[model samples]
Target: MDAKTFKVEDTKNGTDHMLPMSDVLHALFLQRHNDTGEEQYVFRREGKKGHLVDVRDSVKKVRDKSDLSFTVHDLRRSFITCAEGLDISPYTLKKLLNHKATGDVTSGYLVITAERLRAAMQQITDAILQHAEIEKTTLIQRDNL
Candidate 1:
């Protein structure tokens, strides 16, 4: 991952997209990189893809431990709902989700930069963290590391 953005392979579209990272994400990714060293994939595992593809088992374990009922798609849906609630631009949200604006001519004309996406991502992340009752000071302290 770059300091501000990460490249993700969109399996649905068979394309790669660069998505901005929020400050919290940047910190977390930096820590992960440090722990894993220079690996081809950030979240590598002994899998067919050599990286985390299906998280169902992990999610199931978490669900069993915490008694939480949710799926991976639920998280995506929640993110989209949160982004929409935060009034992030439709195009930016689409880009964030790595969704192509098929049949939309207007979307083709818009150029959303990494910086812009970073700002949007930070905003959404902040809102989500705040709603989750995570203190801002805790995030600030993490960013310092």
Candidate 2:
């Protein structure tokens, strides 16, 4: 595929950001699109044209049912920590998080490539899978680690 992407708009910084979607993300989004083909919003209220204004209660409900004790922000922190552990370049990570670069002279000259970003994303995915003891169809035998 040539440059598959999804975008988020109206950020706190007053900018629209577009991000390339990885294969798995693309698949998930495609599924959502298909499921909500006739709807104006993918996760809308009943008979509404817009999406739900808040998903915190839904997230909390699920969190309460699970053994994991983490807020949505915790997941964000975990993702960043895992990506850093995989040695992703700070620039790439910043871009992934849609964070503005600091006033570093070198950051101005850096042009991050899609291929490099994809590689970093894949590494992060692999790392997450490994952490969950999931690889392919089998749970990685913990003793092997």
Candidate 3:
């Protein structure tokens, strides 16, 4: 509806109980389950920054429920698709995805700042949750299928 926005405090956590991205990845890397005896996820503490988590695990649940197949990259692609389905433009998408429009490798190497990326991601997140305001139920929002 309104232009997507987020405040700096949007990501703030409590002083006593806080769960950062690093902590989640750390647990996913070295931690194993006691009952199921399976690792929750595969991650490395020293891996490249912003490298997406192994989404296969989450996608597997979707595949089983839907009786279909898909890949992790498909998830990212679907985000763009959902935005486009709402008539979001390619130029806007380039901004939303924090990608450079210039094709020249040398000249087009303009860096996408983290602030811009976060803002773009917030746009998608806000759009996805917008419909939650429609229904009269306890559900906050639905996940991508």
Best by TM-score, which number? 1
lDDT of 3 by residue, 60-143 (tens): 878999898878567669778767776655655665543556775643555655355544554555565464353212232223
Q: Residue 139: error of model 1 in Å?
A: 6.0
Which of 2 and 3 is ahead in TM-score?
2
Clashes of 3: 0
* Global lDDT of each candidate: 0.82, 0.71, 0.45
Q: After superposition, how far is residue 16 of candidate 1 from its true place, in Å?
A: 1.4
RMSD of 3: 12.1
Question: Taking the candidates one at a time, how many backbone clashes does each contain?
Answer: 0, 0, 0
Q: Which scores better on lDDT, 1 or 3?
A: 1
| Stretch of 10 with least lDDT, candidate 3 | 1-10
- lDDT-better candidate, 2 vs 3: 2
Q: Give TM-scores for every candidate, taking all chains together and pairing residue i with residue i.
A: 0.84, 0.77, 0.38
**Which residue pairs in candidate 3 have backbone atoms (N, alpha carbon, C) closer than 3 angstroms, thus clashing?**
none
The better-scoring model by TM-score among 1 and 3 is 1
Candidate 3 global CA lDDT score = 0.45
